[model samples]
Target: MTAATTAAPVGHDTAPTGHDLAEVGRSPATLRTFLHGLPGVDQVGADQRAAMLATRSIKTTAKAWAIDLAIRMVDLTTLEGADTPGKVRALGAKARRPDPTDAGCPPVAAVCVYPAMVPVAAEALAGSGVHLASVATAFPAGQAPLDVKLADTRAAVAAGADEIDMVISRGAFLAGRYHEVYDEIVAVKQTCGDAHLKVILETGELASYDNVRRASWLAMLAGADFIKTSTGKVPVAATLPVTLIMLEAVRDFHAVTGRRIGVKPAGGIRTTKDAIRYLVLVNETAGDGWLTPDLFRFGASSLLNDLLMQRAKLATGAYSGPDYVTLD
Candidate 1:
C-alpha cells in the first residue's frame, strides 16, 4: 500500500492551501468555474481500472485483515420508514459487537439511522465507541426547503447524533445552481455543529461521471467531511467506477488543499469479496491513509453479516453455514 503524502487530516481546522481554492465557493460563477475547470474523468479507463483492481486477489492473512478492516469501517445502517426503536437498538447492539460469539471481533465504525431514530440509536450506543450517524436534509430525496433541512440537521444533532449524512440538492445541482447546493451544504454543516457532515451525491441521478466529479468537489469545498456515493434508496446505488472517481477526487483535492476528506460507497456492496475489492481500490487510489474508518466507510447493513460469515470461515477453516450470522 502506498503511503499518503498529505498531512492534513479529515476535519482539520487549518485553512485551505491555495488562495483561489480558498475563494472557490464565494459565488456561483467561481464555484461553476472551479467545478467545470476540474479535469474530466475518462469513463472507459475508469471502468477498466476498477474492473482490473477487482481482480486483484487477497488471501490468507491479508484476506483476514481485509475482512476485519471492512467490518470496522462499516456504517451499519437501518434507514427505513418502518424502523422502530427496537430495531434501531438491536442494530446498535450488533454494531457494538458484530460477532457476539467472538469477543475478539471489533466493533463497527457507526450506526446510521433516520432523524426520528437518532435518540433511540444514541441511547443504545451510549458510552460505546461506535458513532451515531443520522440522515437529515429530507433524506433520500433532498426536496425540502433550506430552513426545513437546517432544522432537520439541528434536531438530529440535538438528539445526540455525532454524524450527519445529508443529501445534496440534486435538482439544484442538475440545474447548474452550484451556489445553491454549496450554500445548503454550508448551512447543514453549520447546523451540524461539532457533528461530522457527510454529503451524499446520489450519483445515480448525476447522469454522468463528470457530474459526479463536480458534485464531489462541490461537497468538499462546501465543508463536507465526507463525499458519499448514494443514499442506497435509489435503484442504481454505489458502483465501483463511481466510487473510483470519488476516490480520485478526494486524492486530488488533498494534493491541492492538504485536507484529506473521506469517501463512502453505500448500497449494493455485500459479501467479503466485494468489500475487499473496495479496500484494494482505496489502497491503490487514495493510499493507505484512508484504510481506517476515519477516512473511509461502507454504508451498509447486510454487508456486515457477510463479513462476519467470511470471518468465521477464516477462523475455523470452514464455512459457518447460512445461519452463521443474523440477517440484517
Candidate 2:
C-alpha cells in the first residue's frame, strides 16, 4: 500500500463539516459521539508502513539537505528539574548557533523550557529569530485544577514566551470527560493570547492507537495550533507509528476545515537517521506543506548533535567525532 493509504476514512457518520465543527464540543455526548466515530487504526498496517518508510534512503546532496532541514525542525529543549539559568543560557546559545564553527549551519527552530525559565530563555534568545517556548499548565503530568493551569499559562506568556506548550488532562480524557479536557484547552488558548498553543496529548498514557487518534482530533477541535506526541517524561515517547497516526489526523482535519495544524513528536528522537525517517513520514503522509518548521518540529536536546556530526560527514567526507559537537 502507498504511504497515503494508512487508515480508512474517518467514519462517515461523524465526518466533520462546518456545522459539525461548530457543534463538536458543545456537550459531553456530542464530543463522545464524534471522537468514538473516528475510524479505528490498523495497528499492524501502521507498524509495517512505518518500517517500510524507514528503509527508504536519501544519499549525498539530498542527505545533506535532509540533515539541515531536520536541524531547523528541532526544538532544542532542556526540561530537567535540575535545570539552572546558566544551563538554559547555554541551551539558548546552542539554539542560536547549533554549530559555532560552521557559519552555514542553520539555527534550530525554537528553544523549549519550563515556565519559570521562560524569562531567562527570552533574554538569551533576544532578537535571534528563534522562538521561545515554555511548558506550562503543569506540564508532563497536567494534574492541576483549571484555574491553576490558566494561571500557569498566563505567567509564561507574560514572561515573554511566544509559544506555550500545555498538557491535556489525560485523567479526564480517559474517563470520557472530554468536555472537561476541551474546556481546559480552550481556557489555556485564551490565556495564551497572541502566543501559539501546542496541546500535548501525552499519547504514551492514552493506551491505544484509537485513543491516540481520538485525542488528536479532540485537541484540534478544542483549538490546538499543534498536537504534540509526548512530554519526554514518558517511557514510550515519539514512535514512528504514533507520529504517522497524528499526521493522518491533521491531514484529514485540514481537508475538512481548510486550516492547517502542526504536529510535534517530542522525545526519544536522538539520531540523524531517526529525524530523516520522520521527515520522510511527513512528506509522504501529510504532503510537502507540513515539511517546513512552521508545521513540523522535533522536541529534542541531543538530536541536534547527531545531525551536526552527520552534516559534517557529508561536507568533509569524514565523520566528526562526538568531541566536535557540544553535549546538551
Candidate 3:
C-alpha cells in the first residue's frame, strides 16, 4: 500500500519516520524509461558538459556561495567525528562570529554531527542559528535490522539533533524488495516526531538510472521530507547525473500531489564547480521552486575550506588560511 500523505516533520527536530516508500510496482525498465526523459539528462550534450566546466569562470563569490550552500548538508559520523571534529568545531565557532560588513559570511544550513556529538555541535553553534543534524538508521552501510535503525534515530533526536539524516536500504532496494525500503523510511519518519527526515539514496550503488528514479519516488511516497544522495561512504556519492535523476523525481512528485519535496545531493562533492553543477541541476531541472537552501541541499565533508578559500580570494584576490573560516 502507498503511504497516505502526511505533514512534514518539525522545524528542527531530529526524529526519524517509520513509514516506507510504498511500492509503485513499476518495472525497472519503465522507471528508467521515465527517468531518461528528464530534460536535464537528455539535453546534456558535450557542449553543456563543457559549459558546466566553464562555470569555473563564475565570480569566486558565486563559487563560494554555492559551495557554502552545499556544505550545510554534511553528514558526520561518531567514528569519523574525532578526526573531523576540529574542522567542524572550528566552522561552528566561526559561524558564531560573522563579519556583518562582509556579505560572504552567510551561515551553513546546519552542522551535521553524530547523535553523540549533537551537544558538541549545539554548543559550538550555540546561538548562531545554524541547525544541528545527525545520521541515524544504520548510517554508512545501513545493513542493520529495521528496529536497530529506528532506535538509532530516536536516540539521535533525544541527543539534541535538530534534523535526522538516514539512509534507505539500498541492499533491499537492489534486491527488488521496494516495500521493505519504503517501510524502513516510514518507520524512521514516524520516530523523528518533530525532526526533518533527509533520506539518503546511495545513488552510486543503485546501478541504473531507472533504479535511482524508482527508489527516489518510493522514498518520497514513503514519507521522506527530503530525498538525499550518497552517504559519503562510497567512492561515488553525489554526481550530477545521479542528482539530476533525483531532482526529476522531486519535480514529478510535486506535480502529482501539489506538494513540494526537498532534495539533498550529498557525498564526495568537493570543489566549487561540483557545487555549482548540482545547483544548476536543481535550478534548470526542478525549476526555480527548489533553488533556496530550504528546498535543496548538498552533502559534503570537505567543501567548506574550499568555499572559504574561494570566498577569501574573491574578496581579497588571495586565499586565506583554514583558520580564517574557523569551525566552532
Candidate 4:
C-alpha cells in the first residue's frame, strides 16, 4: 500500500516540533509484553491480513449490522447548505427523522460533525434517541494552547454536543511533554460535563507500537471516555497494527483502573467487510461487552453506503443505490 493510503489522517500542518517515534523513548519490550497479553494482538501479523480478507466473504446481516458494525461516520461527511444554525438543525432533524421500518440500520451511534455543526446535530437528535458528537480543540491538528483546547471542549458541550473528539498536541506529545498531554486531556475531560471525551492519538504520526501504547495509557490516565485513532483527515489512519496496539492499551487500562474506555478506528474503512474485521477485533479482545455500539465504533465517510448496499443485498439478494435511502 502507498504511504498516502495508510498514513494517519488526523495530524496535518500542526506546528512541527521535530517529534517522531524515536524521540518518545517508547519501549519496544513494553509494547511487546502488552501485545502478547491481548487476545488478538497476535493477529497483527500475517493473520490480520488473512482475517481482513476472510471478512470479505462473510455476508452482512441486520443483526450484526446493528449490534456489531454501527458507528458514527465522520471526517468526510459534509453538510449541504450547513452555513447557518438553521441549516444544521434541519440536517439534524433529517437525521433524527428515520423510519422504524426503513431497512432499519441502527441510527449511527451518533452524528459527528464539525464544531460549527454540533448544535445542529444536538438539536436534531434531541428526543429522537440519537446522540450528538463534535470534533474540537484545533481538531486534526492539536497544535493549540492548553487553555484553548479546554475552551474548545467547553464550547462544544455548551453548544449541545454530547461527545467531544479532540486531537492531542502532537508537538507537545512528541517532545516528551507527557504531563502537558495528560493535563490537556484532564482539563478537556473536566469541561465535558455530561458529554463524553474521545482522545485521538493520531497514531500514524506516532510511528510505532510503543508510542501508541504510551499515548493510549496517558490519555486514559488523564480521563478519556474513549481512545480513537486518527481524524480521518491525515495520511496514515486506522490500521490493524496500530489498532492492535491501541486495543492492548484499552485492556491494560481496564485492568489498572477498572474503567472501559471505548475504541474507535477512523479514516480508511470504506466497506462493510472491513467494518466486520473491526467488530471481530472488539469481540475477541474486549469480549461481549465491547460488542455493543457503546464500546466499539468505526469512523468513516463512505462506509455507510457500503453498509447500506450490503444490508439491502442481504434482504433482497440484489444491489440497490446507496442514495436511494437519502436522509434528506
Model 2 alpha-carbon miss at residue 251, Å: 0.3
Give per-residue CA lDDT, model 2, range 167-281, as digits (tens).
9999999999999999999999989999999999999999999999999999999999999999999898999999988998998899889989999999999999999999888
Give the clashing residue pairs of candidate 4, or none: 6-236, 7-235, 7-236, 7-237, 8-235, 8-236, 9-233, 9-234
Cα lDDT tens digits for candidate 3, 175-270? 776667777887899999999899988888988666777677778877788998888878877776667667767776776666788998776767
Best by TM-score: 2
TM-scores for all predictions = 0.95, 0.96, 0.77, 0.77
Worst 10 residues of 2 by lDDT: 1-10
What are the per-residue Cα lDDT tens digits for candidate 4 across 268-307? 8887767766665555555556765577777765676566
Winner on lDDT (1 vs 3): 1
lDDT of 1 by residue, 1-328 (tens): 3453432222213323477797898888988988887777778888888898889897898888989999999999998889889999899899999999999999999999999999999999999889999999999899999999999999999999999999999999999999999999999998999999999999999999989988998999999999999999999999998998899888878878889999999999988899999998898888898899999999998999999988998899888888778777
Model 3, runs deviating above 4 Å? 1-57, 60-88, 95-104, 321-328
TM-score of 2: 0.96
lDDT of 4: 0.65
**lDDT of candidates 1 onward, in order:** 0.90, 0.91, 0.67, 0.65
Model 3 scores a TM of 0.77
Candidate 4 wrongly placed segments (more than 4 Å): 1-94, 97-103
